[model samples]
Target: MAKAIMVQGTMSNAGKSLIVAGLCRIFKQDGYRVAPFKAQNMALNSFITKEGLEMGRAQVVQAEAAGIEPSVLMNPVLLKPTNDTRSQVIINGEVSGNMSAKEYYLKKRDIVPEIQKAYQKLDSLYDIIVIEGAGSPAEINLKENDIVNMHMAKLAKAPVLLAGDIDRGGVFASLAGTMMLFDDSERAMVKGILINKFRGDKTILQPGLDMLEELIHVPAIGVIPYLSVDIDDEDSLTERFEKKGAVGMIDIAVIRLPRISNFTDFNVLEYMPGVTLRYVKTVEELRQPDLIILPGTKNTMEDLLWIRQNGLEASILKHAALGTPIFGVCGGYQMLGTELSDPYGVEAGGTISGMGLLPAKTIFEKEKTRTRVKGRFHSQITGLLSELSGIELEGYEIHMGQTRPIDHQIACLAVLDEISGQQSEEYAGMCDHHIYGSYIHGIFDGEGAAQALVSALLKAKGLDCEEISSVNMRDYKEQQYDLLAKGIRENIDMDQVYQILEKGV
Candidate 1:
């Protein structure tokens, strides 16, 4: 059986996920088999497993830190919000149904059996389990049927480390208020209190920490400094979107849809030298750029309407006509087509006009298309990204629609050599002049794909390509995990953490 320790936060984006990942890395470094578990997660960013199961990306990062393969068992129940009021419920990596906020709240407890099954399976296989909680346990109005915070800790018999974000201010009040709201059972499960994202002198902060511990009767475990490491974020709440960098030698603009998912797809480009990647939400932000990318979103129709109504559609069309390269992925790919038809009412029920950048038509389906594939760009790809021709790439597909060609001018972008590791002949992506679209989420992460695109852009501007440089994404990710583990070791007391795990409630 695995010993469990839980990390709960006073609010969202309190660094709970990052801390769990750090613990996973620490346990892995100590030669113990470890895994991350989150019984329920609500996020737009998600990943597909080798088995074609969908899970939250936060768990995927922790799994990577543990030096283990990402599995659906890490996140058994995923709630992908389609709108403010509703979310698509996925259980064990498969879509169960769409339910409104109230509907899910009323029925979430019904999924407890599945959560237990997943936790038990991981317990049998690993020596330690690092669990993460969502939002706050102190939501007074939503605590009765709570299955993610206090309820989860009790279920796993996990000792909890309650963390409050001092960088957000009100750390003392938030931590004390959270503890004050916790009933006796819930308060007893918390082994320690942590002040996360501390930026200033520890000497000045020590008195407050001491006062917090004395008030809550829980030891101040550690004051974790603001982490500088780069890792995949959980959802749109990520600070990455607020980044506003002046245009570099090579400027890349990504349309920040209200429901953007997997914007991490562009994280690689941010690391390239002289490459400025910016998320543009308004027409003013969508100023002329060397490259324009329309990223994936949870709701294609609604987000497309947003761009259309907000005049970004006109700006993007102007750029497209001027021969600037435009790329789209998944939902963005669907929006680039000439028309989007939802006969099954999978999305908003209707036939809507697409951006008409690509000679393709999309039809939403009842069942999602999920698969992992290895492939290469087709020989016929032309124009700006012609440099990507025949270059190998690997990514997973997770969408609810299929695009069909509308004309001979459009050519297949890539040929899938393998599907889920089986030799097969299947095609993905399409190219029409300077416009390109694909269902593959991590298309840019392919070996040399980003470089090829950057090289072409530089050549078009007649700029010297000598300084064009980028990191190998796989190696970059490994270094980030090590940095996070090192930060935890320096700022956090791992010895006490081990004792808390061993002496679980």
Candidate 2:
């Protein structure tokens, strides 16, 4: 069995995922095989594995930091919320069914075996496993069925490092209050504490840290400074959506759907100099730009209705009329079609009119399309993005609908040469005039794809592409992981962390 350590947060979004990722990178750098584990993850952001199965993207990011290919064993249970009270449950990367909060709570015991199996598999393979806990463990109302926090720590025989976010305020109270709520056995499992996201000098915070250690009887591990590393978060609560539009040489606007999923598809564009990618939720925010994007959504039909009601749909149509170069991916691609029909209740079980930017139509299906594909842009793709012609792209697809051209004039945007390890030339996506849409997520992450698109947008704006530069996202992410690991190593006590791992509860 492998040695393990758990990172449990004082609250949701307390930086558990990032801490786990940074520790994974540090361990890998120290010449030990490491992996990340989350008993369950609830988020709209997901990734499809090589086996055409879906898992949470948080674990995928940690896997990248660890320099390992992502696998389902890292995350055994995934819950994509359909509404405030209901979620689509996925076990072992396959859809189990839809269940409400109460329904899932009653059946939580059945999921323990799956979690145990996944953890055992990872334990057998890696020298160390860095486990991340969701939300706080002190929710007395929910602790009866607790499966992610203290329960997970005990299951893996892991010592806990409870982290509190000082930036959110009440770090000391939250830390102490959490300890007060824990049972004697649960409190015994906690070996250390970490005060995260501190923006001030540690010398000023030492008094509070010392007081916290006295109250909880747990050693204060470290005070991690607030960092500005570029990495994708797992959920919509990410601060990326709050960014005010910046004045750039080329402005790109993405419609911020209420249930937007996989917005990371456009994150690489943020790194391209002279390019500004902004998420616009209202018509007033949708400024005139070089490119307009419709990003993926978990519920396309309902989100489209949101656009219609909020007047963003009219604004987008107005932009498309003037040839502002509209682009979309996955559910966003469906929104660009003439119409969307959901006959199987997969989404809304009704028909809805689309943005009509392209001559395509979509139908929601019960069967989801999940696959990793390799393809290239059509050699003769038209409009401002024609520079993307003949460029190779590799990405995965995860959607619950099928789109087809409504008219013969709609040109296929790309031809997929391989899907899920099988060789097949399949026509995918559509391109009509300056409007481009594809079913592939991370379409621009491939080498040269983002560069060409940005260069094209720059050229259309009468600017020199040589003035701005972009690096491959893979290399960029590696640099970010190193920065994160460096921050963790310099601030956190690695020697104490190692002892905690060895002296498991």
RMSD of each: 0.9, 1.0
- Candidate 1 per-residue C-alpha lDDT over 393-458 given as tens digits, one digit per residue, 9 for 90 to 100: 888999999999899656889999988879999889899889999999788798788888888889
Q: Could you estimate the TM-score for every candidate?
A: 0.99, 0.99
- The lDDT for every candidate, in the order shown, is 0.92, 0.91
Best by lDDT: 1
The reply for model 1, stretches above 4 Å from the true place, is none
TM-score for candidate 2:
0.99
Indicate the TM-score of model 1: 0.99
Candidate 1 clashing pairs?
A: none
lDDT score, candidate 2? 0.91
